[model samples]
Target: MKNSLKLLLSSALLLTLAACQGQDVATLNLEGGDNIVGGSKVSSWSDLSKHVLSILTGPGERIQICTAVLIRDNIALTAAHCVYQKNKIRIAYGVDLYEQGNEIPVDKVVIHELYGGPGSGRNDLALIRIAGNLPRKYKPVALPSVADTPYQGQELITVGYGRTGWMKGAENDGRLRQVAVNVDSTDMNKIWIGRSNGKGICQGDSGGPTFLKKNGEYYPIGIASYILMMSDDPAKKCLEGGVLMNVVSYLPWIHQNLPSLN
Candidate 1:
């Protein structure tokens, strides 16, 4: 979500906001949390990185940054909170925010009906239909089908434009970065990954993509939601792993909205 951690941490004192900013994932029961350890800078929209996107939301100087994944030429998937209750939402297709790329206007936004609000929600997923075609260099990632049972120790690849460090002021340069994490547990709506292993997420990453690799290909299986706090202070967000919205479980709803998905 654009406002992610830095901006939204101002909401409540020690609690209230559990998810990322803007989407403010409504404090989940994430079992484990992690850091963005061993992440490498992405220089191009090729390979698996092609599907990742940066979201510029809000208005004027307060425009917040977030991330998303393209599933079709015009359809992109993201966290509902990231785009919800916001304005002038634009989708940027590029590796770095400052670099040259296509920033397309969003023609349609499909936020989950179950989404609670900016400060809370159950299902955090959302979809964006751009007014123009995606850039030539950009490509969609493979999507998953029915929801799969999330087991402990399962590995996944996560990509987003969020803070690299967990601290409140940690640098979130709006660059495309990625990290690998393992599933620590699960519940009805989210898959918990990491827990103080020093690898996870912070602000500006909400609604990003978490991929499951199979047969030499990557498939988006999860959506980046929020960070579980390690202490009463929201700054302690990064130390805990993080929560991922299970994409498989939302396929029916997704296909229902973007009927062209299937």
Candidate 2:
């Protein structure tokens, strides 16, 4: 069963990547190990911790395949690639997979106009508006100042419900997890993270939140974009590093679409 699931996921990723060929941006299908590489499972949920959510695509099977972050009572921030498809997108809030927490139907989705398709990873952002307000436990994460810049070697925290291992067929436990990743480098619109330590983002983590701690408060700085493969292993895990779409770079677009949240 696990092997079948992995194969299906790989095929889906390949199809998405193939569709993006010829674009200036780099592209790679989604593949990951058991969970967030080198990260630990979160045993409990924090007050704002529920801000991180699992995104389920498709209609019948409804797989909890991607992660997203709540930025307002009704608005969520996620990778454009995650919602590029025509399938129904649902948001699950909570730490456990079996708990059947609040599941909200997405009322509308707004992908960045310039998003260069799924694998391009350029302008990779989207805003999802739920049909109604979120519960009290779920709170929006604060956005970073557009002027802020990530520096190399700076410590950052990532939270998501993604796969756990680098080996093939490693399963996602469906539990929310957190990991500390150091910023390896940065560009005008992206932040690269990870190193030999193995701690980094993985498949099913796309659209999750990358946070910057300031004055002891966590602020959303980037959205999980894609993995930067450094190996030719068939497993296709994030052995090299990962890329994050700098949230600051899209502040104007975000504010323009969700002006009420700003």
Candidate 3:
């Protein structure tokens, strides 16, 4: 079953544990380079910690995933694939995934009508509605109505509950790390090149927010969709780099379908 799951989504898992493992903070080379990520870079993990969340099935279930910020207080955003398999999806606030903490039940799920597979090249966004008011500690991140396009040397930050380590034994440890990678280009939804060669969004980091740091403010620009591990083919729909759908490009569809996501 696990093998089948990976084949379907191309998600990499650390063998010793179910947690994800692809990239880390130390790997990011934030200095200016060939691929510009954003206009600025993230200041600290403290500023973006609230945006990180654990998407789980129960207090201690194996079927857990990671997600990221969308709105200020009411809505939680993630990949359509995360909520599709199970309806009883819950968002756990704070860094740890094991504790019940301030976990909140998701009352409703709104997926894009045109959403296909994770590789379908369509809208892959989903908005999860909590049953009641959100906890004070779990503040939301703001989604930009519009975003500035990426340049050659601009830096960007990606935060999520992905694998803390790049090896098998440390999967699912549930520590959120931020990596600063320069965006190579935004040709389509497929190929996203980064200056930091070893940094990227892994399996568990799916649906996490990719921030465009500008003038000390982080804007939700894209949702982490897929990561490219071994290619440089520009003609392919997916490449050997990370793939993130532009949230700013789909703003109209997102707001019209899931107002809470706005």
Candidate 4:
């Protein structure tokens, strides 16, 4: 994640706002929640990293503002906030410098029209179509057929290249890390905790995937969205922890809008 983005410690104290400031992801207080949870890490493009893509704003932006996951053969899933007007956006996949397969570009991008919210729902998600078929080297992750599972206190894996440090200007890349977090039951819209182990998504991790560990496989669960309400007093400027969005809530929308890629 970039240094400019803001992550909230708790969702309860979030100040109701329309748009997120430069780096502030003002949603609701997310700290000490019992519903959301996470873990896991990936440094580069592997079987795991292949599912992870850098959602770059432009060809020469020099930095990834967020991360995303490939849900279908050529469809990449992410947060709608990552999409901006006239921005040169694309997904970088199969990024193995030493191997034959490397980066794959996105063919197009589509975000929900009501992502910013119509002032009622906290809708925030997007889909990206790559320019070509997904090579065998890169396969997409499976989405949950039902949202009946992944209850609060459940375990999950949070993977991304977000900044490792808490202060501004701190950054992480290539290398991925995983941390265990608990779920915030009340806030069905978020994934809670993760900071106790000194790890959580920030800045560049905006669109990264939060996977649920079940049986012996990982299922896509949440997409890192906005963070509202700081851990400490904002007037005192204290940074405590942060929160992430739950993508599972949009399962019905995802099924209805996703274009069949076969």
Please name the candidate that would achieve the greatest TM-score relative to the true structure. Answer: 2
Off by over 4 Å in 1: 1-38, 147-149, 233-235, 260-262
lDDT of 4 by residue, 67-180 (tens): 678787788787766654325665544332113223556666777766654212256677878886656766678887555445666766776544444343343333344555
Write down the lDDT of every candidate, Cα atoms only.
Answer: 0.68, 0.71, 0.55, 0.52
Top lDDT prediction, candidate number:
2
How many pairs collide in each candidate, listed in order?
Answer: 19, 8, 13, 41
Off by over 4 Å in 2: 1-27, 31-35, 62-64, 260-262
Task: Give residue 148's error in model 3 in angstroms.
Answer: 1.9
After TM-score superposition, the amount by which residue 201's alpha carbon in candidate 3 deviates from its true location, in angstroms, is 1.4
Off by over 4 Å in 3: 1-45, 58-60, 99-101, 119-121, 188-191, 231-240, 260-262
lDDT of 2 at 101: 47
User: Which consecutive 10 residues in model 3 have the weakest lDDT in total?
Assistant: 29-38
**Model 3: per-residue Cα lDDT over 1-262, one tens digit each:** 3333222112223221232123332222110001112222223247776666656542222344557574747677766666665465777665544333456777788887777764454566777777676556556666676547555556778777645333434344444566776677775443264525555565466677778877777787777765553432322211235666677777777677665433
Query: Which sequence of candidate numbers ranks them by TM-score, best first?
Result: 2, 1, 3, 4
User: For residues 1-262, could you state the per-residue lDDT of candidate 1 as single tens digits?
Assistant: 3444334323321132243334334354221112244476776734766788777665534455667889888889988877875456887767765554457788788889888665454788888887887767777776786544556799888887756675555555556877778898877678887855666655567788888888877788888777765465555556566788888888888889987433
**Residue 41 lDDT in candidate 1:** 74
lDDT of 2 by residue, 90-186 (tens): 7776776544445677878889899887667789888988777666778777788865678899898888876665464655556788889999888
Worst 10 residues of 4 by lDDT: 9-18
Q: What TM-score, to 2 decimals, does candidate 3 have?
A: 0.72
